[model samples]
Target: MKIQFLNQEHETKFQELRLGMAEYYRNNKEYLSVVYIMAGNEELHRKMNRYFNTKEGMFSSDDMFNEEDFSSGNRILAKLAVHLFNDNETVSPLDIISALDDEWFQLALNAIHFRRYGISSGYDFPEEKLYM
Candidate 1:
């Protein structure tokens, strides 16, 4: 995501947060698949960092990228996501959220909910046309 730190300190904090999440899932390793999509936004990253970098929360965006262009899409986390999603095995919501490269926590939440509810792509939530 496009993450712009107000200063170097903020940048450092962001990195710490991202790395912390990565380490958590690496140790757990209990899932069939995971996919992390990075939003690639600087402001969003900073906002997320400020909002999530809390002691009692499940989300954070510290150590976020300076810009979407700076991110290497083929990082260890990305690889893991590919492996997990392709394997078709049940995974952990927290674990999956931790692996996300993107700063968009909402997507992470959606991923967790989707998996928990057993709904794949193209599957409507209620199986009905709401507009009709």
Candidate 2:
């Protein structure tokens, strides 16, 4: 489950995605706060609540993940990917193998990971894994 940049191009794309995601989060902190709460980040939820002087409301994980405003969905997916895989200097692609429960997140992670690493499964497979 290790993830490594396939080459310079892959590393560059990953860096670009990290920067874009950082910008997205900075510009949409409130929305992302809600997402973090729904993603089970209690510490983030508390920090956001105190920072924003607000409390959690009726938002659900589905609502946050399925947000259709601007590229919120993509941003949310990226945030989750960061949360789940941004540990260690190099991540094991297998780290995300068990996250197939959420099909959308799985798809998004695979897409992002593949776009940045030139591989989807991180494991051996007969056919080429291409994510659309």
Candidate 3:
């Protein structure tokens, strides 16, 4: 969605999410290729390449979301981002809403809501309302 995530930590986290999704598709090449077309800033594309090219093997979710690794958390975020970005009806806020559906985004949203409004998982606003 229309998140600025001005802070580097948040940005890095977002990137990690994207890399995670890309890695999944990378592993499922034949199936994923025909589905969604990935597009974003140059950095996002680069991260996707890195995750795709990463060596194949068994890795834990902790390892997948690590800043050092292409992380499952990151992949989760990426998958959400891709889904929102590809949706013709999605807009900026809707994109953020879509991203928040991811585990990483949920964590961020829960923290922010708890700190600012004392809410967790917050309100489940519809994507349609977000667009307006």
Among these predictions, the greatest lDDT belongs to 2
Q: Write the per-residue lDDT of candidate 2 for residues 1-132, one digit (tens) a residue.
A: 233323344334433333334343422334332332223323333322232221322223334334423243434444453343332123244544543335444444544544344423223423432222
Global lDDT scores for all candidate models: 0.34, 0.36, 0.35
User: Against the hidden true structure, what lDDT does model 3 obtain?
Assistant: 0.35
Residue 99 displacement (Å), model 2: 17
Tell me the spans in candidate 2 whose CA falls farther than 4 Å from its real position: 1-70, 87-122, 127-132
Stretches > 4 Å off in candidate 1? 1-80, 87-103, 120-132
Q: Each candidate's TM vs. the true structure?
A: 0.24, 0.22, 0.24
Write the residue-wise lDDT of candidate 1 on 9-127 in tens digits. Answer: 44454334434554434222222113122222343343333433224323322232222222332233333333334432234555546654443334444333423443232332242
What TM-score would candidate 3 get against the native? 0.24
Regions of candidate 3 where Cα sits further than 4 Å from its true position: 1-3, 6-45, 49-70, 87-103, 106-132
Model 2 has an lDDT value of 0.36
Residues forming the 10-long window of minimal summed lDDT in candidate 1: 27-36
Model 3, range 1-132, lDDT digits (tens) per residue? 232332445445434543555454432422122111122223334454443332342222233234433344445434443333233222244545654445345543433332233212222323332110
